[model samples]
Target: MTDQSTVHSVTYDLLRTLKLTTVFGNPGSTEQTFLQDFPEDFSYVLALQEASVIAMADAFAQVTGRPALVNVHSSAGMGNAVGNLVAASHANTPLIVTSGQQHRELVIGEPYLGNREATTLPKPWVKWSYEPARAEDVPEAFMRAYAEALQPPAGPVYLSIPMDDWNRPLSGFDRVRTVSHRVAPDPQRLRGFADRISASRRPALVFGPEVDRSGGWDAAIALAEKLSARVYGAPLPDRAAFPEDHRLFGGPLGMSVKTISDRLAGHDLVVVIGAEVFRYYPYVPGDYLPDGTALLQITGDPAAAAAARVGDSLLGDPGLAIELLLDLVAEGSTRTAPEPMARPRELPQTPNSPLTPPEVYAALSRVRPADAVIVNESTSTMAQQLEWLPTTRTGSFFATASGGIGWGTPAAVGVALGDRDRGVVRPVVGLIGDGSFQYSVQAIWTAAQHDLPIVYVVMRNHEYSILKSFAVLEQTPGVPGLDLPGLDIASVARGFGCRAVEVKSGEDLEREFTAALSAGTTTVIVVPTQPQKAML
Candidate 1:
């Protein structure tokens, strides 16, 4: 089956076999050669900037549950994509990132556009990085990157291919190769873990992003319900792992270590499924867990498991592990309910009045469809959204776990593409903050071009409200550039070719949102609001 032909044809055939026919990128001069005569079966998704390229790939991969191929320009473009790269790495999204290198002959001269040491740039963030030694090794590198990215603790990998490598004659890579995505736990360890679950008096289950990523949401819910375990989401979860409206759900844990330790104090056993034992922020020194409380984590990341601050870890396929645990626990597990946790309720909104986030989120709760997919980057308003618009569907809600901004806009567009590609016709809603919206504002144009039915709710508070909270918390006074003066989001959306409207009042917010949802096109609803002091 050796092609013994140009590397381009062989790689294209291999990519088609792997079903990685979609490529997202923002091309540059150096990348032109590789992109020339691109195959018809492969569709190229264009983004305005390199940063949006990675964010779009992030959501696309998560939604499809497969590795997404991303192409970017040379060194400068790679630099532009670093923020989103950090976010994707933090969430462990499987992305294969390739950047075009300058001409292979320009090695000693340090030519104008040449990236001398290309592999060093994206390191520590990407799982693997390389610039292939020979032109013929390009396809092999890509296939290896695919397997590396798809492996556990899956993260983005980088490949910097020289511009001329695309045309080199290749061989021995013509056959299709299967890639493995599942890892089963040791039978002895699984049984012991199940015994622990069955023996614990008051157990708690903390579901995480992988529950959505690995299709373990139902298994997580079943385990929680079977043992009357209170379900809490991992801190600042990137995906909704459990039904937020379910009786056993206790909401997301706090990012503060002491806060989390205090919340789960009474539970005798805390079993975290498909998430790290703890992901903390705003470092508050405290005990990792309550005294006498046992913490167990089941995850695919060996690094995370080895580095866990406290407790035991079981490595395996999360979906299968949960199923096994469910079967084992059923033999002898009793039920007991925990005390109900109080959730914040929405305040009543006055007619024709300026809307608050709580009011907008509440109205969204009332109007949001059961199957609508949400891409959230409304940082200051996240608490309100979490409180009012509780997500019930697994994989329905997506956010950045690394606290990166500018991800939602492009991610929404990419999720729309993913849905369309997978033949799922659900509405996509993007919740973006005014500050975050400005970062990747151009992403709106892609949605407009595709006429994707996405409703973008711009929470226009005109300030970096989260940074203001950070200023206060750190006692760093006189922080400049927190307030964004006189920037019109509606005008910006319109400039990007999206139908835009500014909603000043609660009534206007409700009515306009209802109209936008069924508008059959990409629309941006800018809801003006005053900054809320509700800091995390």
Candidate 2:
């Protein structure tokens, strides 16, 4: 041992040195020792359930651009968190997911609560997963997990430390080094791709969340301007990569294969930047490509680049790749500017009308602080939200990249925690659906406990409208759980120690929403609206 230190002492030193001072978790008996005499500098964001805890960590990691630490119970806790764990992995969020294992002696006998194969629990999702063979190996495993999580195409990584390991004395790690987290592109290949974009008569750019994650937003816009290309945000983007209000913005692509192909058919060369080659849902059988369109996708994820359905791929940093392309593309007389795309309407106020998603978003647009961080999971109203909200601010929009339903509310709490910790005092707002709200309703308690200033606007449609749409579209008959009845969301929020209110009409919306914002210390305003959807 280099310094002859205890395991807990060494681990604490590493965390403080690395500036990883925040943790999020739901504690259990096995984790009690790890939490003993917990350091005061390290803020622990607590949640009632494992799912909320991981999601809260996921959002914090995304915001801080660093790996956030999360600890869970044994296999049961991991099982509870698997959904959000998969979602975080899909978003490539850098989260160090650690779990407390049963005592080493008991583990051999497959005790009642032992995670028999602990490492396999988060497999295929975590970048690396391990349960150290020896107590001394625990510290080394943690260091490796942190480094691997911060590496490019970053995602969650797992470490299962035996409950007794935290107290073991005389610890030493095999190595301690700085982690480099970038993969620069090959020069020759990048140049050839740039040449294609420069030569194409008609080009389009598909911007995705990685553009934001990789700090490529400026580069994405610069490249589009240089080539005079029409820009479309990749389908169902959890991150708003481009300014929706910009003239260059062509709006988001769709979830169906044929729809995406149809949107890009007019352009000869399509460049998908910093996102998956394409992410489509709802089994609509059709060709992925148009008759003649060619695709070039630039992504940081090796898996995304390798598994692209049809497009050619460039593996590198999204910001770096775009910056290089901007430098390589030459502007000429033939570099004709494309026509500006359709802009979202700033609809005039319709007095005494039924409260709809579009109207609610429009109202929010008028009142919300310009720099507010938007965490949304209003799935059915997502299309309307995208149309109405202009995510011009960088890293302002976030969604469930993995299409998980219950992340929005807890994610909002996590975002507030990050904003507060970073000294970024932007109002954190979450737009969530009633059905999605019920999934993690307990999050309000966490928010209240921390005194986080988060304004939650629940779109109370009293039904799983998105599921209803999908059911009708796919010809699924007699779905029993689609309707959500007798859910008093505001009352429940109040029960969780939140300031809550309900809005029954447009007048109520404007008045109560404004009041919620003013009184916000984790406030919830439930606005019951018609189940009738204007658009799918």
TM-score versus the correct structure, for each prediction: 0.96, 0.96
Q: Model 2: clashing residue pairs?
A: none
lDDT by residue for model 2 over 1-536, one digit each (tens)?
Answer: 23457787778778877777888999988888778778888888889999999889999888888889998988999989998998899999999998889998899899877887998888888999999888877777778888999998899999888888888885455467788888888899899998888888888889998899988888887778777788998888888888887778887877778778878887888889888878888768677888788999899999999888988898998888888887898773376676676654655455434477777877787778888889998888877887777788789999998888889999998898888777788888899999999888898899999988899999888899988888888899898889988998988999999999887666677777677676758899887766645232
Regions of candidate 1 where Cα sits further than 4 Å from its true position: 1-4, 330-333, 349-353
> What are the per-model numbers of colliding residue pairs?
0, 0
Error of 1 at 402 (Å): 1.6
lDDT, each prediction: 0.86, 0.85
Highest-scoring model, lDDT = 1
Off by over 4 Å in 2: 1-4, 171-174, 332-336, 344-354, 532-536
Q: State the local distance difference test value for candidate 2.
A: 0.85
Q: Report the C-alpha displacement of residue 359, candidate 1, in angstroms.
A: 0.4
